[model samples]
Target: MPEDNHSTVTEFILTGFPGLHPEYQGLVSAVLFLVYVLTLTGNVTIVFLFATNRSLHKPMYYIILNLSICDILFSTTTLPKIISKYWFQSETISFTACFVQMYFVHYLGTVNSFILLLMAFDRYVAICHPLRYPIVLKKSTIQILSITAWVIAKTGPLMLVIRAYPLPYCASNIINHCYCDHIGITVLACTDRAPYGFPALVLAMFILLGSLAFIMFSYCSIIIAVLKIANVQGRIKTLSTCSTQLIIISLYYLPRCFVYLASNVGITFSPDLRIVIIMLYSLFPPMINPIIYCLRAKDMRESLWKQFNRRIFTQKAQVPSVSN
Candidate 1:
C-alpha cells in the first residue's frame, strides 16, 4: 500500500452491532445506560467500603480494590460513547478520537487481566500457604504488585498506538463493531502494518496468556491443598471460598478466549453473533465483577448491610454530625 495525499476518510462511522434493528436502538441504549450506571455503582461501592472499613485492609481486599478500580476505568473508557452512539444517533467519531478510545479499551483490559492474576496469587497464598500469606503479601508488597500491573500493561497498547498513530487510513473509515480496536483500525491503514502489528499482538498475547497460565497453575495448587484436608467439612469450606474466584475467573477469561479463538480459527459463526460475543465479554465482566468478586465475600456483604442500615437510621434521625 502507498500513501495518498488526498485520503477522503478523516473519521469513522461505527455501525454498532450490525444486526441490531434500527427501531430497537432506543431500547438498547436505555439498557446500556442502566448497565453502565449499575457497573459504576457496584464498583464504586466496593472501593468506598474498602477505603472506609478498617477490617478490609487485608491482602484479599487490597487485590480486590485494584479489580474494582480497573472495572470502573474499563466501564468509563468504553460505555459512554457507545451509549451516545445509540441514544443520540451520533455514530461518527473522529479518527483521532477513535484510536484514543481503542488505546484505553486495550489498556484498561490489560490492566484488569493483571489484577485478576494478582487476585489469584493472593488466593493461592492464602489457601495453599496460609501461614506465609500475611508475610508474603505485606502492604508494600501488594502495592508493588498493583503498581506493576498498571505500569506494565501499557507497553503493548503504547507500542501499537504509536506505530498506528501515523499510519495512513485510506482503505475505509467504517468500524464494523461497537468501538475502535487495534485490529479494526489497523486493517484500515493504507500500508502494510503487519511488521508492527505482529510484535504488538505477540506482546499482548504474552501478557494475556501468560497471566492466564499462571492463574491456572496457582488455582491447581490451591485445589491440591484443599484436597489434602482429611476432614470433609474443612474441604467443603475451602472449596466454597474458592468458588467465587473461580466463577469470576471463568467470566473474565473464558469468553475472551472464545472470541479470540473464533476470530483466528475461521469459525463459521455469523458476524452479528461474533460481534455480540465480543461485546458481551468486553462489557459484561465489568458490570458483574463487583457482584461476583467483591460483594460475594461474606465480609463485604456484612459491611454493606451495616452501612446501608447506618445511613438509613442516620437519615431517619435527621442528624448532621459532620466529621470528615
Candidate 2:
C-alpha cells in the first residue's frame, strides 16, 4: 500500500467486548463501569495511603507505591474506553491516539512486571540478609533502581510504536480488545512483516522470561535462608513475608506470561476468554496488592486502619465545629 493510501485510514474500530450481545450493552456497561470504578478507587486509595503515611517510607512500601501507580495507569489506559465502546458503541480511535495508548499499555505492563521483580528482591534481601537490608535498600539505591526499571520498560515499546504506526494500515483497522494491544493492532497492519514486531518480541522475552527467572532465583534463595534459621518462630515470621510476596508475584506475573507467550505462539483465544484474561491482567493485581500487603504485614495493616480512623475523626470533628 502506498503512503497516500495509508493516510486515508483516519481511525480504527475496536470490536468492543467480544461475545457481548448488542441488546446487553447496557448491562455489560453497568457491570464494567462498576469494575472500573472499583479498580480506580482501590488503586488510588493505596497510592494515597502509601504517599501520606510517613511510616510507609521504607523500600518495600516505596515499591508498593510504584505498583499502585502502575495499577492506576494500567486500568485507566484500558478500562474506561472499553466501557464506553461497549455502552455507546463508539469504537473509533484515531491512529495517533491508538499509538499513544499502546505505548502506555506496554510501558505500564512492563513496569508492573519489573516492580514485582524488585519486590521479590526486596523480600529476599530482608529475609536472607536482615542486618544489611536497610543499607542495601536505601533511599538512593531505591530511587536509582526505580528509575532504571521505568527506563527499561518504556524504551523498547516507545521505539516499537514509532516504527509500527507509520506503516500502511490500509486494510481493516478494527482492534478486537478494549484497548490498542500490540497483538490486536498487529493484526490490523497492512504489511505482513512489522518493523517493530521483532523488537516487541525481544522486549517481551526480557520482561516475561528474564524478570520471572530473576524473581524465582530470589525466592529460592529466600526460602533456603528461611529454612536455615534455628528458631522456629523466626523461621515462620521470615517465611510468611516471602510467602505473601510470592503469592502476589504469581498472581501478577503468571497471567501476563501466559497471555504474552500465547500471543507470541499464535494461540487465538475466544472473545470471552480474552476479556477475562484482560480483566485478570489489569484489575486483579491492583485489587489484590494492597489487600495482600495490609493483611500480611502487621505494620501496614495498623497504619492503614489508623489512617482510616484518623480521617473519619477529622471529618466528624469538622462537621460538629461547622454546625456549631
Candidate 3:
C-alpha cells in the first residue's frame, strides 16, 4: 500500500450560522450562553435530585439520569467553542481537535436516541405489562441497558472519524456549521465524499427512525393498555405519566426526522436556516427536559419542593441577627 497523503489544513475555523450579520453576533452569543447555562443547570439539577432522593431510585428515573448526563456532555462538547466564536471571536480549532469534537457530537447524539428508546421501553413495561415491570426492569437491568447504549453509540461515530480523518483536506478549512460534524468536515476533503457521506446518512436514518418506530409501537401498546383500565382516574393518571415522555419524544424525534427527510427529498433551506433548525432540535430538549419533569411529574415536583424548602430553611438558620 502507498503512504497516505497528509492534510494541508492544520486548523479549521468554525463559521457558526454562516452569513450571520455582525450586528446580531452578540445577540446570538448571549442567547446561546443562556441556553448553555440553562442546559447545564437543568440537567445537573436532575442528576443531583436523582442522587440525593431515594424515592426516585426506579427504572424510569434511572433512564432519565442517563439522559441528563448525556445532555450535559453533549451541550458541553458543542456549545463552548461556538459561544467563544461568536462572543470572543475565537474560532480556530486544530485539525485533531476538530475531529475529536465531531466524534462526541455524533456519539452523544446516538447515545441520546438509544436512551430515549430505553425510556419508551420503561414506559411500555410499566403500563403495558404492569405486573412484570418491576421484575423485568430492575435497577441492575437499567444500568446494563444504559451502559450498553453509551458503548454501542461509539461505533458509527468512530467509524466516520476513522474514515474521514485520514482523507487529504487540501481544501478550505472553514466549517459552515456551528460544530464540527461528519458532513461539515468530510465535505472539505480533497477526495470523493460519497463514501463517507452515504454511510453516515444511512446510519443516522437507522438510529433515528429505527428507535422512533419502536417508541411509537411501545406507546401504541401503552395507549391500548391504558384504555383497558376500568377506572377513569387510573386511566388519566397513567396517561399523565406517559404524556411527559411523549412530549420529550416528540421534541427529540419529530424535528429531526423532518430536517433529515427534507434535506434528502430536495426541499432546501439556506445553510444558515438549516443550521438554525439543527440547533433548535439539538439544544431545546436539554434545556426543557427537567422543567417538563418538574411540571408534569408529581413525584419530581414534590421532590423539587422538598429540596427547595430544605434550602430555604437552611438559609434562614444561617442568617445572623440581633433580636429587637
Q: Pick the candidate with the highest TM-score.
A: 3
Candidate topping lDDT: 3
lDDT of 2 by residue, 1-53 (tens): 54323555688887777787778888877887887777778777777777788
Relative to the unseen true structure, what is the C-alpha lDDT of residue 220 in candidate 1, on a scale of 0 to 100? 92
Clashing pairs in model 2, backbone N/Cα/C closer than 3 A: none
Model 3 ranges off by over 4 Å? 1-3
Per-model TM-score versus the true fold: 0.93, 0.90, 0.97
Q: Which residues of candidate 1, in runs, are more than 4 Å off? A: 3-8, 319-324
**Each prediction's whole-model lDDT (CA):** 0.85, 0.80, 0.93
Give me the displacement of residue 277 in model 1, in angstroms.
Answer: 0.5
Regarding TM-score, does 1 or 3 come out ahead? 3
Taking every candidate in turn, the Cα RMSD to the unseen true structure, in Å, is 3.6, 2.8, 1.6
**Candidate 2 Cα errors over 4 Å, as ranges:** 1-5, 260-268, 315-324
Return the candidate ranking by TM-score, descending.
3, 1, 2
Quote the positional error of residue 250 for candidate 1 in Å: 0.7
